[model samples]
Target: MAHKVFISYKKEDLQFKNQLVSLFNQNKVDVIDKSLNDIIPSDNLDYVMQVLRRDYLSDSTVTIFLIGEHSSEREGNDFQGRPHQAFIKKELQATLFDRENNSRSGLLGVVLPNMYDKVYQGTSICSTCGGTHNIVAIDDSTVIKEFSANYYIKPHNKCAYTEDDRYAVLVKWDEFYSSPEVFIDQAFDKRKEPVANRVTVYPK
Candidate 1:
């Protein structure tokens, strides 16, 4: 089935975003692009967010977040006077918000090449489980932390988070670009899957 997808990414990652979209086109993948192309034109954050939620994100079935090195950097302050990557955060929040007309989108995190080393290091032996586990560096930003920290349910082993445990499926750029549909389908399935119940759309 052709799924309408919205891409959420920092401006710096536009190149990769273009490449991703192009890959979909070249491969004849069944994906409908719902990403915002033009700027909102208004400086009023609230108004801009309203337009984003109502216009762009309302119909998207999945939101693919491009996680780069600067993706987690807090740039400006929101209405509450707290620092944040206002646009990205708001976009993700809107994607996660379910309403009468709009359902919560399935979330997918794509780690860019620049962040590959930082996010995924070599495997290491887990002290808790005595099993080799992927050494992942996830403390890049509060945005990532807020969304991904809920992957595992409470009282679960930190060293044993399988793909099924994650509310937001994450993949490296190359891996995703190789077979985009596979991951995209996985994300779209989350909408009606049990994992969707564990998702926290709004940040604390």
Candidate 2:
């Protein structure tokens, strides 16, 4: 089956969302961003929360939260003081709905590439609980592994999550294609691959 990915973003991030949607579509991943307009209504915060807690959370195989300046300022949050709330909060809550929801599927974060200044300057608060901001990376296997072990191990919890190796393989494709030589040189141990005795990409 084709991979299912849900994209959560703010209205102000329409352009970025569209770009991601198109990229994933081109790469053959089924995107849930199609409900962009229908999912987030201007006047109905309840509707948005309901859909996330129920519909989107139930069906999506994975979630991709696109972080921007205003993503967490939505109304569902109690307005503690932060600039943005985290989508993971909803994901964890909804993922625990059923006792048997053991599938710890993919969870990814995409930060605005150029918005590091605001993030680093600590100018904004988390729109949800008014906590400090944290940026999680897609390639962090350690975090993913620990989270998976916690959720998927004995006495399984509701917020169980995992990063499939196949997903990592797909992610690595970008690195491989960008600089095949660099990837081969760095990833493979010289002793294990025995490059001196084998064919090398570099000039002999």
TM-score winner: 1
Measured with C-alpha atoms, the lDDT of residue 192 in candidate 1 is: 84
Residue-level lDDT of model 1, residues 152-200, one tens digit each, is 4444555677777777888889999888888888988888877677777
C-alpha lDDT of residue 35 in model 1: 43
Cα shift from native, residue 30, model 1 (Å): 6.4
Question: Tens digit of lDDT per residue, candidate 2, span 5-89?
Answer: 6665667777877876677666665767644346565444445645664666556555555555554323344475422333333
At residue 142, candidate 2 shows an lDDT of 20
lDDT of the candidates, in the order given:
0.73, 0.41
Best by lDDT: 1
| Cα error, candidate 1, residue 157 (Å) | 4.8
* Ten contiguous residues minimizing lDDT sum, candidate 1: 30-39
Give me candidate 1's TM-score against the actual structure. 0.84
What TM-score, over all chains together, does every model reach? Answer: 0.84, 0.44
